[model samples]
Target: MRIGLYATGQAGLEGIVEDIAAAERLGLDSAFLPQLTAWDALTVAALAGPRVPRIGLGTAVVRTYAQHPLALAGQALTAQAATGGRLTLGIGPSHREIVEGGYGLSYDRPARHVREYLQALRPLLRGESTDFRGETLSVSGTVDVPGAEPPPVLVSALGPVLLGIAGELADGTVTVWAGPEVLGEYVVPKITDAAKRAGRPAPRVVASAMLSVTADPDRVRADIRGRFGTAGEFASYRRLLRQQGKAGLEDTVAAGDEDFVAATVARFAAAGVTDLLVSPVGTDEERERTLAFAARLR
Candidate 1:
């Protein structure tokens, strides 16, 4: 499995570019920038592309509620060209709270919205025009980006319905808060079966987790809980945690010494993960230790 870093992009543009460059220096496969409240991930990737030449640049997820499919396709293709085709476009229908409360957009029938979004998006990414009409969206356009190949699209899917949709429509699924048990027993089989039914290739399983190589594992876990406890409360994440028999987000973390962390990562690889994105959590020294250990795994 390819191992990479999950960048929060809290660091400004230059910091983010430096982070990607450092990830490349460490031999990580990719640097996935999240679309949080800070800098725009696609724009950061486009700007960082020319700086960090080898490492892959991806959006852990860009919300689809606010942006139209046609518009996003153009931006993704432009980034793809700028990054020399080292871009993976990961998009999703964000949580209902975030969509309705934050974006002031309707979150009705997210599955249908994603279905319609992909139906129109896939064709445009391939430089083909799409004249489709669906309940949630209607699009008739094509995106043209010379010297840019279509980047693989992955959906941030957790539940069975969205997993099926991702399998049939997307290149893979990007999962967070799912442990090896959930991936092996639930996620991998569900998506793989759906892909087989759709006659698509094996789907990429990109698992994101908080990990640290620290002596005080308990402290790191507590810190993680303090920071990310609310994430476990999210409907989708709560469901995933339940599937894994985990109490909260901290329960999903892989923290300990080198041997323990390595064994945890091995479990993910054995569970059929195609890529593992490590979100290191700890003091600066411990985070660096975690990154160095993760690079050794590569």
Candidate 2:
């Protein structure tokens, strides 16, 4: 399986872009930049695309409700053109809390919204002038971007309904935080079946697993806390971890000996993880070292 690092892109804009450049030189496959408190995913993709041509660029998952389909498709086209077709667009309807509470957007009928959004967005990305109106989206005119190749669109699918929408509309599925049993038993099958039922070819399921690594296990755990305690301990992820046999854990990180870390990663691969995105969950040094180790594994 292919392996690489995942960064939160918090280290300043210029600094983060430079870091990505450095990582590309290190022979990393790709980088996934999250759209958290940061700017929109397309903004970061545009900023980073010109710097690295060999590496793949993708929005981990951009919030669907955050922008109109035309606007999103336009940004995607610009990023794809800027990157010379190296961009992968990962879009999603984020959770209810984040949508309704954080962004103050309606969180109802997310599956329907995703379908409607893609229906409008895909044609525009293809440079096809058309009018589309659905329950959750409406597009009157085309986004005119000459000679733009639409980047492969991936969907963030968790529930089955969303998985069906993802398979029908997207080229791949981007996963997160799911452990071995959960991925093998629930996530993968749902994605595969959804694609098959739609008569679409099998879509790639890229599973991004978070890890905290160091020479010392104790220090590694501390690093995880310092880097991810505020973010990783989100209630929803905690519950998911529990469902994956890591219940009551303060953290879901790889912080033990080589045997331990290797065992964890191997389990993910064995569980059918095609692309392994190792999110370093500690000090920058620890993060780099983890990437080095990940390279060794690759």
Candidate 3:
């Protein structure tokens, strides 16, 4: 399995580039940047792409509602060109709370929204024109970046309908806050089956997990719960936790000593995860330890 480091991109732009460079130096396969209250992920990719020559760079996800397909496709192609085709465009219709409450955008029929979004976005990324008119979206245009290859696209999908849309329209799915049991029984099968039915290549299953290697697993789990309890309240995450027989976000954390942590990561691979993004959590010491350990996995 390909291993990636989840660089939150919480650091400033230059710091973010340094982080990716650091990951690449550690022999990691890729660096994934998240889009939340930080530098724009794609923009950062454009700036940092040339600096980190060997590693794959991707967005854990960029919110689909914020940018039109034409606009997003243009930016994605540009990033691909800058990165020499090392970009993976992960897009999602974020939660209703963030979309409706934060951005004041309609969060209606998200599955349909994403399906339509991909229908318009994918062709544009391939330097082809699109004339699409769906109930939720209507777009006509082409986005071209000279000498740029279309980057692979992934969707952040959890539920069945969205998974169907992801397998049908996108290259793969990137998942967060889900455990191995959920990946094996629900996520992998659904997406893979959809891809097979569509006569597409095997879909990539990229799972992101909170990673910590420590002598005290309980303390790390508590810290994860305290910091991320709100994720448990999100309906989509709640269902995923339940599928994994977890009551809350704390229960879903993969924290342990080195041997145990290694075993947990292997479980994800056994569950058919094509890529694993390890997000270092807890203190500065713990984060560094986790980063070093995950780097060694490469």
- Measured by TM-score, the strongest candidate is 1
Q: Global lDDT of each model?
A: 0.91, 0.77, 0.89
| Count of steric clashes across candidates, in order | 0, 0, 0
Model 1 alpha-carbon drift over 4 Å, by segment: none
For model 2, state the Cα shift of residue 126 in Å: 1.0
Task: Score every model by TM-score.
Answer: 0.98, 0.91, 0.97
On lDDT, the leading prediction is: 1
State residue 24's C-alpha deviation in candidate 3, in Å: 0.4
Writing each residue's lDDT as its tens digit, candidate 2 over 188-287 gives: 7888888898898887777777675566666666655675565445555665766777643335666755577788889878877677777765577767
In TM-score terms, candidate 3 sits at: 0.97
**Root-mean-square deviation of candidate 3:** 1.2
Error of 3 at 75 (Å): 0.8
| Cα displacement (Å) at residue 60, model 1 | 0.9
lDDT of 3 by residue, 66-97 (tens): 99999999889989999998999999998888
Q: How do these models rank on TM-score, best leading? A: 1, 3, 2
Where is the poorest 10-residue window by lDDT in model 2?
247-256
